[model samples]
Target: MKHNRKLNIFLIIIIIVSIIPLTSCIKDNVQPISKTEYMLGTICTITVYDNKPESVIDKAFARIKEIENKMSVNKPGTELDAVADAAGKNFVKVSKDTFYVLKKGKYYSEQSSGAFDITVGPLVKLWGIGTDNARLPSQSEIDEKKSLINYKDLLLDEKDSKVMLKRQGMSLDLGGIAKGYSADEAARILKENGVKHAIVNLGGNILAINTNTNGKPWNIGVQDPFKTRGDPAGGLNVTNKTVVTSGIYERYFEKNGKKYHHILNPFTGYPMDNNLASVTLVTDVSIDADAMTKNIFYLGVDKGMDYVNKKNGLQAIFITKDKKVYVTDGLKGNFQITNSSFKLMDKK
Candidate 1:
């Protein structure tokens, strides 16, 4: 009788143990804290999942704002403006953050073979893309500005943490890479604060932290170049990764029925006519993905494919002007084409 009683008690204990996990999962719920602000020349969104409190999200945004204040070329009295003001004549000492970004900019400039030059600010101002003043530049004006666009002239001093532009008219614009660096910084801050699941979107550059509460990959949509905002050409299943896209559709102006995009070729001082509509990069590093979109888009498909194929852990999705999506072999299963209007090409 005692043996049977003990057996029944053991069975009850087993049942109790089985129910505990479900109850714990129900209790350990995730609350998403999201905040949006107008900064970095675009909308910045930071979302964090925490069961304890919502204060970490604020810190993350503050970090982003701090970066914007230091690096924004449009903002007067900024570190970038300081360097511009001191161009050719003097060296300007900047914050370590500024120095770091400038150094990375130089690295990408060399890697992309000047296809993505931070020193293209002169051209940017002359063309004035992404602003109310945007207009087509005269050939003479384009030629003059092209003379000022040289990444080789940007001198960075590691010893003194200073930067000097060799020419007086030269300017630095971190618009291409700063957003990604800010996103990565925000992620670092969140992780340091013990937050695991979060999403950081600076303008359209996205960094998905870890995974969702159920430990599933976060689905990020690739914007449709033909359609309006929020329309997805396809979807990328990502977790703990950064997804960045550079498309002609992002910033452009219509003039005489011709569209002029912001991504200019440093050689010609005009919008690049690479035939590809958009290039999307996916990687663990946000800054790398951010800068690569511009570089690879400038290279177009053939050279860009050759460049990306040699790199490790880097995947690309190229949407051509003919409504075709070319994905790298590594992203075969992870990328899904949702828009029927676009057809997926065979993997290269």
Candidate 2:
């Protein structure tokens, strides 16, 4: 009986020792927290590496939802709707969120010399791009709507947090910059909650929280303009940065064998015609990258590169119609061209 008891005790000691290593391994491998939702007319995904991921993720998403409710023009009774309703009549008092976004949108409009305009809302509604009603508009209609698309008329009273559209028919569309702003806000929330690693993908406006959990830079693929979605023309390795791509491929329609894309020129009231197919901007803030992309796209490759070069801390990748890729100096080593059919241009 004594020998049998000794053997059982020895076996118990071995079992506990074996279980320790397994438990330690499991504890070290923390699964990433991921969640997705439909918002801002596209899928917004948030993934974070955190000890208490649920709380942080919920807080991050809440901020995005708050922005959408206040800024979305599609949603009736929103602050944007109130401003549009009072256009040419009175100033609409808006929440701080709406005021900040509109203020920044107007700033971009001025910086781009009207190349990017938020007041293009009137024209956007006329074309109805991305909606089932999308169709080619007659020149007369285009001209009429073009008259209402001026960013200068968007008045912002910062002291009182108000917005006023100067003309009766004028409207404000935050679609261009809203998603990027939301992504930035979500990232801010994540960091505030002690999340060290995360990825905020708001409709492909990607903001990497920091380096990947593996301690390597995040690799983001730039979509191929002519191919199906998720097809990569190149990849960028980045850490703690925003990568946003504005391409003709994003929203478009086919009519009479010709393609009409959503990026309209504020000046011409027609789709911006630059030979370039897509422009990707990398910057510290997703909002700036998102707002500046259309301006660069309208500028085309040459002037676009000049604009990107002059801006401190901004890098751009311009993919042309002829399958040539022009990358700003900052991205030379960081951007890898994955598609063999595309040629990386030598420095001009």
Candidate 3:
């Protein structure tokens, strides 16, 4: 989905804060600096707390660069590009990392009953809603693409670490979950590198490792789907968790006075028109949370909440187009609603 508000401003703020020094020690004569940057089509903010020399920060950046090289679609030989190229062709043997991501995609597809599909790539390419070449495809075009879109059609050979699309013209787009996966991977690398406290923000997918240097939960703001530009719509305080959101207001194109968003429903081959404006999921696993946000958005408010409530260790915040907010029972104590425009709905 296309963000109605200009995201450049928010990106700037994230970039600036990511580079500033996180802490300084007065007694030990130590200076701890945190380095961060925006890469891989998402903002990655890495904050490390350590008295180690600048080499640690350099290694962190080096790891991030490695991830960017491996996972980026822009890079010709990357695994993502390989998947894109192998679309409609033979099975593509991917790296273990890529296989793990596809495995999570398939898992969520089953969990959400096909609401979140990686095989919706054909439809996404057809609509081109988020790109400069955005347009509404004809019914026949949508139908043809829909025939090629199904997660069940994706065949995974675990032993060989290969991915195959059952039919011709089928493709896989990891856009929905790649950011979160990268964040999780980056955080894992930091932890392995002896960085205990860190935050990885890949745009809407925010993941925290351990806690902040202050021993407090990391504060994450949920971008208001309807709020005017430059206003805070309140946020959630989370510790060692992942918060990912999928909203119709993110990216889209307008045609015939109607908005066509980037988030396509695999069932309808079009953007979801449910009452929900956005869906945010909180979980220990950012990959699952990322996939679930898109799934819940497509599932609509009622079924989405039902799905979250049924799943253990999952909490969600739902915002309807009419400005109504609903929080699952699991989130009752975890999140605080600060927007007067939002009203909490009681579970039935």
Query: lDDT at 91 for candidate 1?
Result: 94
Segments in model 2 whose C-alpha atoms lie over 4 Å from true places: 1-28
lDDT digits (tens) for residues 127-179 of candidate 1: 77877678888999999989998899999999999899999999998889999
> Which is the winner by lDDT between candidate 2 and candidate 3?
2
lDDT of 2 at 318: 92
Misplaced by over 4 Å in model 3 are: 1-36, 49-77, 80-89, 227-231
The residue-level lDDT of candidate 1 at 114 comes to 92
Ranking by lDDT: 2, 1, 3
Error of 1 at 286 (Å): 1.1
lDDT of candidate 1 vs native?
0.81
Worst 10 residues of 3 by lDDT: 18-27
Comparing 1 and 3 by lDDT, which wins?
A: 1
Which of the predicted structures, 2 or 3, would earn the higher TM-score when compared with the native?
2
Q: Which ten residues in a row have the lowest lDDT in candidate 2?
A: 17-26
Candidate 1: stretches off by over 4 Å: 1-28
lDDT of 2 by residue, 1-348 (tens): 011222333343332221111111112577777776767866567777656648789898899999999988768899888888899999999998888889999999999998899988889889877766788899999999999988999999999998899999999898889988998999999998899877787755888877776677777778788854456788887889998888877677778888888889989998898789999999999999999998999999989999999999999999998899999999989888889999999855
